[model samples]
Target chain A: MTPHDLKQQAQQQLAQQASLDWLSLPQKAQATFAALDMPTRKTEAWKYTPLTALLNTPYFAHTAAGQVDESAAADRLGQLGDVSRLVFVNGHLHPGLSSYSDLENQGIVTLFSNANDAQRELINAELGTAFEPQQHVFATLNYSCIEDGVLIQAPTDFKVQQPIQLVYLSSGEAQPALAQSRVLVYGAAGSSLELIEQYDSLGETNVFHNQMTEISLQPNARLTHLRLQVEHESLSQVNGLHVKLAAGSHYEQHALAFGSALKRNDININFNGSNAYCRLNGVFLSKHKQHIDNHLNLEHGVPHCNSDTVYKGFITDSSRAVFNGRIHIHKHAQKTEAHLNNKNLLLSKQAELDTKPELEIYADDVKCSHGASIGKLDDKSLFYFQSRGIDRATAEAMLCLGFVNEMVEQFPNTAVIELARQRLAEFFNDVDQLNHLWTLE
Target chain B: MSKTPLLEVKDLVAEVDGKTILNGISLTVNPGEVHAIMGPNGSGKSTLANVLAGRDDYEVVSGSVRFKGQDLFELEPEERAREGVFLAFQYPVEIPGVSNMQFLKASVDAVRKHRGQEELDAPSFMKLAREHCKELKLKPEFLKRGVNEGFSGGEKKRNEILQMALLEPSLALLDETDSGLDIDALQVAAEGVNALRNPERSFIVVTHYQRLLNYIVPDYVHVLAGGKIVKSGGRELALELEEKGYSWIQ
Candidate 1:
């Protein structure tokens, strides 16, 4: 059978499971996936990003938890410091590697498949309702055949002190494999939570990790989310994050991503109620024939919601990066304030960056501005460093780090910043000129 | 017995973007002596400072500058910095990502490494930096911020002096350092510069106004106009230029 047929069959089987009510959403998503298939070059959203690796890869379903490196996952979590860390290896949760028993017991965090009856009812309501499926083919595909996923719910007036850490690790078998996992968060009224999710794999692992995360913030709820995609150049990744904010809610997201063979991220934020605020900051890097694409959409359906977003990209050595940010204000989204900015550094002559920032506003009283810039490092800044007795290579490295470090410094979580710096140093060290960057510390 | 001048420039001719700024500018600065170079606008005062620091944009059409008995033009800008040459920029570039302490530490390490000196430990470096901050009347917290990120004009000049104290260059070039400062800041900056003065160090102060000379007294003064040194005299020349202005010597 074809991949599409197999996906439909899985969804049909899930739909028939009488014990699992959440499977109904997957059944619907499967039909949506059939209608809106994987994007191709002709698709406007996927024009500059060719999914050659993903389209050509003969991906087979993942085997049960392959080669779980207990020590490695444990060591990584230890380095991440004190947090409710949940680790999944090869699409299977590793209870020994995870340390969120307290959260799991409270029903604040639990596996979607293993949730209790009441918890399952809550998850069923919030599982697939954050973003529109028509624009996100990968997310629909992921939901249709999700193997196992996480569900985090913060009840009314509940405030979590520590940021929750989700560690998604891939350990591929000999054959090319696809591992799909997900996370759904429901922040109830007056609730707040912080999340730090990391996606990583070991050297040369041939794994395509398809993951999705959905978050819903009720009125007066606040959520601070951070995502890091680093240290896996050989893998293919398609990830999506969708957030829905209610009245008087707040959402802030920070992402630091590195390019791989084929990496695409679809981020969507929808303001369903008024007086909600959103802040998003993202930095992406690509080099050595890698490709990274970020398609972001901010929807303002209500009034008095403000959003500020900035995403920066650094492409070098024949790498390609694509950024599309769209802010859509409905007819009644008056008094809405929005700003979007994207600045990119195209290092090598052959490197390419395609950026488009669009503001579609129907509200007459709204204030909105958007701008995108793509260029090489500033010569004046380089000269400034050189004048201070720094060599050109070191100066370039500093400047490159500085470009991305600006956004990274704004992250509210210090642990995430430290982790990002470590990963960024490692990612930049791949290029010859940016070596010895760690010595600058 | 005679000692070689710390810096010797012979018929220095320079240009930027096809525009000749300094034409046949020749001067000498001996050790422990401060030479004030008074000039009007468009007289190559800043260009001379830039060329001495080996700025790449300023092309040396013809001339030679010898620092510490070596060809100054042959070294890279960083190398020139390592070889005890410091140019306190008129407008210090704001580097947003690099913190002040980090930039200063990197710079100090580069110079120290080039001089074959051992690197300072973190604690030692912080202690020394805080001491310099106190000396400049700058809050130690400024060291934690980006280089010149939000510093006021006077604060930036004092930061330059702080860097000067840390790098401890032998040949210092002050380019329009006092233009943006009020009297109090100028005194603080001058006092910072004066503290670094020693028998092994020499300074070439380039300024549009002679008020800075009142704080950091100069041994000799030269008037640069139409791109060349039109007149030279003792400390009295700065006073003369301050009284009569560059049009008298032009």
Candidate 2:
């Protein structure tokens, strides 16, 4: 994979760009893009998730279309209703199909293309700074070729009334498409905001989605972010979400991954200020040959900070899921409270889950614990349920759901919890063994 | 489902962890009959109940348990449950994440399926569950909580009865249901048990004292000591044993 060949591939992919934004990237960006093509298992960050399946297919950068079917996009998004909605098609913002107030005038929401000189300078200073581009080839690739994304900011002393949702829908009707998106949110002191990002592909076409979202919070600010990746099973997606919390700030994230043939999500958070807090929860349901990997890293850099993480996975058929969560506390970060937990349910003998929850603490004053468990359903509980007159199959289902519901029920947002539950039900419906195990009574 | 002997245990021998517990215990119960097995601590009364319930902890070495004219040991625990064998655990295990309502629904559905009936929907199931809870004097809010999580001893006992009432097992085995109950709770639980009695159902109440037997009087009383039935008599045996203690049975 020479740089010349990579450059030619990029040129061919961007040939039909309807907008000039695709060509506006600086020369350095092009050089960086050409340096990295498709990350392989050799890439440390992408060790568990191989990108060869995606690279095997030729994927072209998606171009601005004449008009996308708004109803189709709505139908997919509405599957989990009660979410504040924003629609994006082909890596371009579609404000008409989007449902949300224009907060640009209030200085709360600003498109990356619409940012002024000052905002651009701020983004340039902070963007791609929290992550090491050289180490993460996907991040480097996304940063270099990203055409447009969303930038949201909540000023100090401001509290948003509604949750901000960004829905990204990929439409590649004719060709194998690649859609790249980025999101940056900065919350000021004493501010709070709920943000949601959803990813879905409209067509059953072979496509690739690369996305990066970053969040930074100041002292006393609170932010809850929900991310859902339910793209078409034919698509391959690699997503990165980076969050930095200042002193006394709070940040919470919940993710649900249910689609894509090969999907990987990388999440990193740093507690830079004293008394900062972070909560990360996720659920991954995979079936057939789908491959999903989630890598999470949380750094307790300051004192008196607390972070809790729980990730659950249900794998069926020949599907595989990998979860790696690591927590680190600096010597100066005394009195930190952090806990990380991961559990997986294997419904088939061929299904697999590789999970690791690691903890590194320099400060002895911290209260940190990490637990990772991979086990079949508890036969005692199953027998107990069955002895009550429940059949064996239904008994198994109830116990399985109970195992995962421990964390799902903790979601503060009722709507998000319901959506996750609905997705769980849909997944269980297809799992024949689980379908035989139990149904909702 | 007849008014004859509901459960007939013959030369029942059970073991746990390679240690023999029940050494050739025998008992029989007729439909509409209540039998009380009173004994000292570790006298194998609870082991007998557990064996009847087909607990994996205890291995039945030699036994012919005839419940409603079927080979009880041949059935799985769930199958035995469908055959009307119920054991109210002395120490009910708390399932922290499973809601009580959901647990009850699963149990009821299993029983209904065993009876070749359709599963009840949410509304009907809730109605039946509520009615049973009321009969056991259990609070409706308890259904929303995890099964036995944070429940007091008496509450767990009442929940057991509630489950028994919902399932309506023919051979209900009360394993020390009166162990941790106060007088009021004991009265309520005994009353719940009394109300479930019918011509086609039978109960084997295992207790240490004669207090519970006073509330739900039994037709026959058996004194079990050293893993065997030492004496069998009318209900007066419970009072005589409570007065003289187990030294006489030993």
Candidate 3:
């Protein structure tokens, strides 16, 4: 089938859902989705990530009314210690597998399906304020088909001591499924929060996950967002994250993605007020014919704002990756300081990486710089390690680990760091030469 | 000391990038002896060190190197290291995220495993590392940072000595380890080397100056000119060369 036919079929299936008729936002989102065209290779923003694989398959809209095994969900929460968790199966919230007693008492967690009158007003005011629906096709489709989502609010001057984790699991065993999940977070003036969004799959199934997350930080607010997507290799995922920072607010995001058949992540940050700070750090690993792309855009709309971005990638086998990082400074945004760096390591001869880093500064007084490098490991460094009694295979593993460890160390939680390290080791273990070297802890 | 030498290089000829550097150089180092090889600039001092370590960039045109009565050319670089051959690099490479403690533990464990010795546990390794750091006048926290990342010249040289102390190689090749050191750093490095001297271990200290010999006196001094050892004598040769310069020896 053509891409347009698939879009029409998806729209018809989404229109049949009972929840879409009750909400005006869903109605508006459906109109926006109809007005926009599906992104192809010719699209400027999505030139590197093709939609052929996602559109060629016959996929039906996923429903939250599916049975989920309690033990399976509990087993997936392996040692993420002391954090409040909210579990979602397919696209619906599973209350039996979720634990948010302390968070509910502090009025920090609110489910969109069960939002009260006051909570609904707050969710409506800020739910779709971060992005333009006409410009983001996947985000619009996510909003139009989203069954239920989570709303996390940190009150003014409140500080959350524990992290809040949102786990989304795909359990479509019968057929090819499509899931649209949404997350809205608000940090009030002078408040702080640490949020983690995790994605996983239950089985080896063909599932497409289209997710959107919108976050807004008020004046002097702080948020540390950590995202991990490590689904089955057969699955595909497209994620869009839009964040806006107010005056004196601080926003830091670190994302670790293990590429599946196809994966793309688009992250955009806008400085709406002066003197705000934002840091975007990420690492993505692709192996065994997988494709991963990351596009990061930072807009310095106000004066005296600063942004620092660094992304590292490792690709093996015939896998390919694309990284595009752009920093834009407005005309009136003087004294803006921005830096972007993208570094990649290609492990196999067939692996490929395409990276572009750009700095567009309209302000004459801004300090913006960008750099990108894509190559194999240094031969001299490898020789140095081999001369120290380490075998060549072990030396290569150590250097590869060291390359990715720079961003992994930036994770705020130690448990997440350990998880990322384990996954990285597993990825390297596929290569015969580097099978057992990752056991050095 | 035993009659059999620990290391014997017979007419070694090596080339880097198709250009000959070491031309028919022969040397023999017996146990418990410190042999200093001094040479002028472009005399192939560093090339000889690199060739001994089995660097792939330096092609062995025609030569033979034997360590403990075994052909060193038959083994890889790591194999030579496991068989008790150590080369302290002139310019150490910087590794960004691999900590010094981790690298040292791996090296020490590999060597120990080859010699049928038990590996040191974390606590024992930390204790030994702290002791070596104190002797070398380095802060214990240096062990936690990346290997040689952002380290000063003196610090890199001291780190190489610390590795030599931990591995305890039978044949230690010091490749200009005192080139960029201040007087205090040189003395600390010389003391570290002096403490490791024993009857069963030998050293080939490669230098360009006689200042370092004041602390760790060599039993034999050889002046290399045009890739060949032109002069060989006792420790007094180093003093005479220091006074007369390398030009007079040629």
| Candidate 2 residue-wise lDDT at A164 | 80
lDDT of 1 by residue, A46-147 (tens): 899866786566554433345666886565552666789888776667788789988888878988778888877877788789887898887887777655
Worst 10 residues of 3 chain B by lDDT: B1-10
Interface root-mean-square deviation, candidate 3: 1.2
- Best-to-worst order by TM-score is 1, 3, 2
Q: Could you give candidate 3's per-residue lDDT for residues B147-240 as a string of tens digits?
A: 8988999999999999999999898889998899999999999999999999889988999999999998999998898888889999999999
lDDT digits (tens) for residues B124-181 of candidate 1: 9999999999999999889988889989999999998998999999989999999889
What TM-score goes with each of the models?
0.94, 0.90, 0.94
Interface RMSD of each: 1.3, 1.9, 1.2
Off by over 4 Å in 1: A1-19, A60-66, A116-118, B244-250
Judged by DockQ cut-offs, is candidate 1 incorrect, acceptable, medium or high? Answer: medium
lDDT tens per residue, model 2, A1-441: 433444466566654333224224334455665666555576666677756666566564443352478777667664434444568775667877776555776768877778887677666666776665655666666666555667788888899767787888877656666667778888989999988777766766565677888888989999988877766667788788888888889888877787457888889898889989899988887888889999999988889999989888877788888999999999999999999999888888998888889899899898999999888887667656656766677677676777666656666777766666665666666676565433453
Clashing pairs in 3: none
In candidate 1, residue A16 scores what lDDT? 38
Note the Cα lDDT for every prediction shown: 0.85, 0.79, 0.85
- After superposing candidate 3, which stretches have Cα over 4 Å from the reference? A20-23, A61-66, B121-123, B137-140
TM-score of 2: 0.90
Cα shift from native, residue A92, model 3 (Å): 2.0
